[model samples]
Structures are given as structure tokens and as C-alpha cells.
Target: MKPSHAIQGKTSEIKLLIESYGFVSPAIFGSTASGTDLDGSDLDILAIIPAGMRGKISLFDIQHLEAELEALTGVVVDFNVENSMPDHLRPPIEREKVML
Candidate 1:
């Protein structure tokens, strides 16, 4: 199955997972977003936290979410936080991201 379809099939679970981790605006980028994902391709995820919740979250929380998501999808996951990412990396990801 395509990566997007795999993700879509687990959308509700993913949504709940992200919300539980205080992440909002979940998106998929890179190969999965562009429909070119092959088996073993890592899933690239971008998520933003609401300003109000930012101070409450920790790195461990984010890493836990990443691991949980990878377990859920049975694929490697590369999770990126929009707020913490370098400015230079934003535009290209934004250009290709598919919102979840």
C-alpha cells in the first residue's frame, strides 16, 4: 500500500496521538507527501504546537510521540516541530506538506 493510504487508514489513531502529545497541525512531507514513498522509506512528519502549550511540552514528550507513531505505522518516522526547526528548512517542507 502507498504510505499515504497507510497513514490515512490510521488517521484517527494518529490524530489522537498527536493531540495527546500537544501537537497540532500535523502534516506529512518528503516522499510520502509526494506519492513516491517506497518500502523502507522513512515517514517525514511536521507538527506544530499551539503557542499556549509550547512551554508545557518537553523533548521526551516529542520523542515518545515519534516512537509511538512509528510503532503505529510500522515504518520509521522523522518528526519535526515547526517552531523549533531552522528557518532554512521551512519553506521547502511547507511547499510539499500534506495536511493531516
Candidate 2:
């Protein structure tokens, strides 16, 4: 099912931002993809970040990106580095993944 128009637009903006950062195979999951979002629902993103870029991303860098996405999308964002995610976390995200 398609997400609401507002969320869809925000997701698009987020995808563009992630793309600009050169992260590949960005996917969104959780409430954003499930269409069960409430007023406080946050956006969940999984990205296949390059190994070279991996070392460059820190808590601070991730925080900065999160802030940028929130500003651009008006939604709280939870960003996940696909390679770093635990095996258990992979299943649910994969099941509902919306690859951008």
C-alpha cells in the first residue's frame, strides 16, 4: 500500500538527500512503509553505505544527517547502516522494505 501523500513527499525528499550523500540502495521501512503511521511515527531508513564511507560516519555524522532529514521531511528519522544492522533486525526491514 502507498503511504499518505505527505509522508510520500517527505520520503522522496529523504531519498534525494540520501542519494546526494552517495549512499546506495536506500530503503525505507517501519511505519513509513507500512502506512500505519501515527502523529508521532518516525521514519526508518536503511541504506547500503559504501565501506569507504563507513569509516567516515560517526555518531556525530549520523546525528547531522538525521537533523538534515528532519528539517527536509518534517519527520523524525531513524537511520540504519544496512551492513551494521543485526541479523534479527534485517528480517522485518527486508519484509516491508521500500527501496528507493
Could you tally the backbone clashes for each prediction?
Answer: 0, 0
Model 1: runs farther than 4 Å from truth? none
Kindly list the per-residue Cα lDDT of model 1 for residues 1-100, writing each as its tens digit.
Answer: 4566668679778878988888899988999999899877888888898989978989888889989998898888888889998999988998999888
Model 1 Cα RMSD, Å? Answer: 1.5
User: Which one is best on lDDT?
Assistant: 1
- To one decimal, what is the Cα RMSD in angstroms of model 2 from the true structure? 2.9
Tens-digit lDDT string for candidate 2 (1-100): 2234445646577678886776778887888788787776777888977976877667777778878877776767788888889998888888998887
Q: Give the local distance difference test score of model 1.
A: 0.86
Cα deviation in Å at residue 59, candidate 2? 2.2
